[model samples]
Target: MYNALMGTAATTAVGAGLTLYYLEKNSAHANMEAEGLHPADYPFPQKKLFGTFDHASIRRGFQVFKEVCSACHSLDLVHWRNLVDVAYTEDEVREMAEEFEYTDGPDDKGEMFERPGKLTDPIPRPYANEEAARAANAGALPPDLSLITKARHGGVDYIYALLTGYCDPPAGVEVREGLNYNPYFPGGAIAMAQNIFDGVVEYEDGTPNTASQIAKDVVTFLNWAAEPELDDRKKIGAKALLLFSSLTLMALWIKRNRWHTLKSRKIAFNSPKNWNKKPNPPSKN
Candidate 1:
């Protein structure tokens, strides 16, 4: 009876496994055949152990964001002063801030008025509020980009893919009127359209501004914005590790030195035969 029950259980398990295998195979085939969806090539920046931001790329990315993405996305966590020596010089940052007018005071007249932005001011938003932003973008709210690179699954690669992934829907797939097809996006449809193109922004450093280059640079900038203190953190960690390692070596040396006598000491034991040699004592008696 037990043998029969075991056979029944094995048969059921094999059937279930076959069913799952076929289902997974069919799903993979469907994904491969789907239009406008393809696995993105991983970016080089993520491959290194001590991967650092490409500052020039980051600067170009900031330009793209400032000119294009700022129309939709808000970078609320970033401050003008934070740009100093990172993306822009202090003088350049100040000048950039002066271009935007921010609502400053409700002073003597108890009414608010616009004033030129200062170094301490946050980046200005295109919309006054979330409602306004949504209304402008046909009810789709653009996400804040402060931590976007870290928030998404593939990090920089995802952003770069999404930016460059726009394409026509496959023959069998039906794309809704407003939604665009992007294979890299989870649902294979995205609300945001392709924003980057060749010569979208001229680089001051003479780097060719291709579509891929723009996407990569903007992604780099966003990554930096997501973690501005990355360089400092790495530096501090490296220093701490060095100090700890040096101290550990010193401690090991001290320990070995302290135990040297005990480790090197030798002892000799006399045999019982030697103890029996009491002739000198007997002669004295």
Candidate 2:
């Protein structure tokens, strides 16, 4: 009886929770529609199991982040060595690290001192701590770009849309100070200003640095940073699939060959009465 009562109570609670959830979801959707906000879609390049990343785009995206996004956002998850061979040569990576002034330990004085960055060092922070970051950005903390693509709901497409969605608020909409209108953001008002603009960063490879192009590139880089082992994972998956497929085919072939004779062989059957009659007929002959 206790178990039955417990089960009934649990079911009732779950049903009530589900009812409330659906109610809230529908209310939210209605609110969004009333505000002229809809899901923003962007054409994100697909990543395939057999395909490799576009390294050139990644490099350009890194440039965009370093020049513009790095000022406010942090990429502490990425290391200077990660860029080696993927985005830059060893010499270039070394040079890039040297450009940053990182703090290192003192030798004899037991004091921390500033020194150039090393390959193993994490990407530098824009501010000393979260307090400083928020203070500088009017109390809005800039999220880390290293995993932003994965952290968001729609991944790369959502990021791309958000970056390019900044525009004047709709008629009858009043945007607060320090807030910019963006259709892709949840409330249609974002703290970050319009960061991407045409010719914002001069592409080193001479590609046109349009706003859309920059947004796409930076999103790609963030996606790559979020999943740095994507290429290796894909390659291993493809190889494993190929190997398993080949083995399955070979097993099928061997099974058919082994069973061919038994499958094709003919068999005959006779009645017991016929055998008994055959012996009587032979004796008469």
* Number of the top lDDT candidate: 2
Q: Clashing residue pairs, candidate 2?
A: none
lDDT of 1 by residue, 27-81 (tens): 4555543333344546556336566677887899899999889989999999999
Query: What is the C-alpha lDDT profile of model 2 across 1-285, one tens digit per residue?
Result: 999999999999999999998765444554672353443455555454366678889999999999999999999899999999888999998999999998889858999999999899998989999999999999999998889988987688778888888888879888899998887788788899998999999997999999999998998899989989988888898899999999999989987998889888999987776665544455554
List residue ranges in candidate 1 displaced over 4 A: 1-41, 263-285
Would you list the C-alpha lDDT of every candidate in the order shown?
0.84, 0.86
Best by TM-score: 2
Error of 1 at 285 (Å): 24
Consecutive 10-residue window with the lowest summed lDDT within model 1: 32-41
Residue 150, candidate 1: alpha-carbon lDDT: 88
